[model samples]
Target: MSADVNTGTREFILPDLGEGLTEAELISWKVEIGDEVHVDQMVVEVESAKSVVELPCPYAGQVVSLHANAGDTVSAGQALLTVAEAGVEMGAGDEGDGGTPASVSQSGSSTENSSGANLIGYGTSEPKTRSAKKRSFGGKHAAAPAVPTVIPDAPSQPPAETPASPSNSSTTANDRVSPVSSPLVRKLAKDHGISAKSLPGTGPGGVVTRADVMAAIESGAGAAAHVPAGTSPAKASSPAASSDQSDRDTRTPITGLRKVVSERLTKSRQEIPEATIWLDVDATELLATKKALEARTGEKYSLLSLVARFVVAGLKKYPIINSSIDTAAGEIVTHGDINLGLAAQTPRGLMVPVVHGAGELSLRQLRDSVSGTVGKAASGKFDPSELTGGTFTLNNYGVFGVDGSAPIINLPEVAMLGLGRIKDRPWVVDGELTVRKVMYLSFVFDHRACDGQEPSEFLTFVADCIENPISLLPEL
Candidate 1:
């Protein structure tokens, strides 16, 4: 099968969305085939490993075709779509010339085009410019006639075969490659001793989906009568074996922000040698100070804001804790400004939204910044840039009623401070036993960046501020 190739049609391949990421999942396409798109107009939305980003078209023309559908994972440098230059005539190709136009197969692979257009970080096609009259599409010019295009049909498949005799099928099913698109579906098939290749896939292009695998299992393909060797027949045939139908377990693929968080946490644990030290601090004075300030000025000040101020003051004294490890340079890199990361729990997950220059902000400013950033994170409106470049992390787990945790250090940052719930506890003050409001402060640091003494001193300094809020006045 061949397509009518248009010489003026330019193929736009997916460009590299930085941080060494190789691919992205198509979320949705904003423009359809035969639609006139302007330069810099958003064409599609894609979810990369980091975040969901909208891709803009670089050239102004009519969208000739879409290469992949929504939910399809496309690799960098792969053709995404084709756009025909406005006012350009379609010319027939030579009979001897054999090339497939930018077309996508039912199997989700594209036919390579030698004359494909390229973007930065991919191929080497130069950018082309049309005449000024055809440069921008507006009003009447935008209403181009919708040209009907024929999309190639998915490959044909043979008639479905019934389950073969156990002796012949078991080995054949296990050895054959499964035409599955998702890794999770393949895993499910393997766990049940079911061969995905033997089952007729109801998904596009005969690709096996999770639903198809489950259907095969329900149809007795994974019956205990044909259980493979070394497996318990009783366990396989039991009602519990089919309990997955009751929604006992659910598997969700880690993608988008969650995937990024997983990779970053794994890298931090593998690369950084960390140590945690915790101390209990009297927070009666700090709470009283906040109340007094709010009453006198008619302005509310959060405990987190006060704690953040104390952290900044402590960082000034022990600047080493505010530094990050530059492994590539073999040095500890310290910053002149403090970008404080406040860990907030959102509906999606935990995210650390950064306050760019916390050292320069007053208590009120700090309170506002924390509130605004947290609001944005909860609504999923915060930009990816706002989630990065944090020099030190301040996690207030106390809100969740937790007392303490040996929190992981947010890399490449050297340290993270955890604040536990403040509760009234029996304490000795001036040789008398009394109830005092106390909180646990857990400090974790990268041992490579600083020795035990510096972090200990930093934690102690913050603890002192909490105990005696008057001491923070001078620093403020």
Candidate 2:
């Protein structure tokens, strides 16, 4: 929605957080009503698809109204807050002649500074590239874009009655690229196999919002979306029906991150013919090696980072598992940059934080990266971009006191390596029964990409590295 003019207040629409992200859940408000706020002041914290981002307000004014409450899922371009500032007018800079917000411009200059925090897409727009660009996560999966200088924070759901769009931003179906700046809208379109270009957008400047895609999906556009077996498509819940059900049971509406995880896992299960294999390994040597390294260097290294070293080497030796399937292209895409992801349970939910280029990092650098990213994940403060572009994932269910698990593979990626709890278990050492520090490695792979042998070799290599840490030196 574009900025609305009241006598003195100016609306601050949710600025685009680049990587195709369309909506975010409001976590908390940093400022209260009537509080004085400066330009670039952190106004609120929002949780995008995978990260918690603090949105900075661009206008310096007295805080007026918060359109949505905490935990509200705000769509991109929706009105978030209104500011009443002196000398602030509904100028051309605030919106285009057609009344659409300027945030839709996908420029290369993103974030406050080029060397600032790991933010989303570029911000500065060139006159030639001022056209509304299709928003996408950099890879198969992406985070939200940055808030541009012209636009500040945005969003709450629009009113039940749809607002009329400006006449210039018409939705005529010609040979035009649909102005889809929201990743959520694109995702909904792709999930239903509905090409957005076929439908007319109701958003400002003809940008496709999630609602338009949903309407097209409901209208039976293109291929029918796959509904989970034994489950029918969900319908809009009636208030009366929901009220009656609430008396009998506590039914929480599934939305936001939980909804995303559910959909992603369902897709993974439906599309992937994944097979799991597990083996117990003697990790006594690996423990000793970690302790020895710490004692000599007087530096701390986590088991995860140390194990990551082995996983990195194993991936190099067998790169087939470090890949994703391009369903549209019918191609198996192997990644040159090994972005390592770790699956962990955070307060928000199960999130896989990614380290962009894990393959090139040394053991110490890997430890630092893993530690920093994992810590941020635990606290639920990691940047959204850090959650995308992962080639492989490592799950340490061991910390949960579990021996083994057949975990679901993160989508796009073909494989996931699971580490079980290590304990003193009796093992055969040199043909003799002896107590050793043992752990289980559970490997899951998409059978579509490779047969059982490739993953078996990769798993065996990882297990060997754990059983004999020194054996990894050759690969080093």
Model 2 per-residue lDDT tens digits across residues 1-476? 22223323444566676667777877898987667777677888888776777887765666555555565567766656656565444453332212322243232232221223222332322112233321221121221222111111223634223322436434335334444544455655665556675567555344466677767755555343433346555643343454355347543546667878998999999999999999999999999999999999999999999999999998998999999999989999988889999997888788888987899999999999999987876676667777789999999999989999998999999999999999999999899999999999999999988999999999999999998999999999
Model 1: colliding residue pairs: none
Predicted candidate 1 versus true structure: per-residue lDDT over 332-397, tens digit per residue: 998888999998776557788899999999878988998788677655545667877899999999
Q: Name the regions of candidate 2 deviating beyond 4 angstroms.
A: 4-8, 87-248
TM-score of 1: 0.71
The positional error of residue 339 in candidate 2, measured at the CA in angstroms, is: 1.0
What's each prediction's clash count? 0, 18
Q: Candidate 2, residue 293: CA error in Å?
A: 1.8
Give Cα distance to truth, residue 332, candidate 2, Å.
0.6
Poorest 10 consecutive residues of model 2 by lDDT?
143-152
TM-score versus the correct structure, for each prediction: 0.71, 0.67
> Candidate 1: misplaced stretches above 4 Å?
1-12, 29-37, 59-72, 81-247
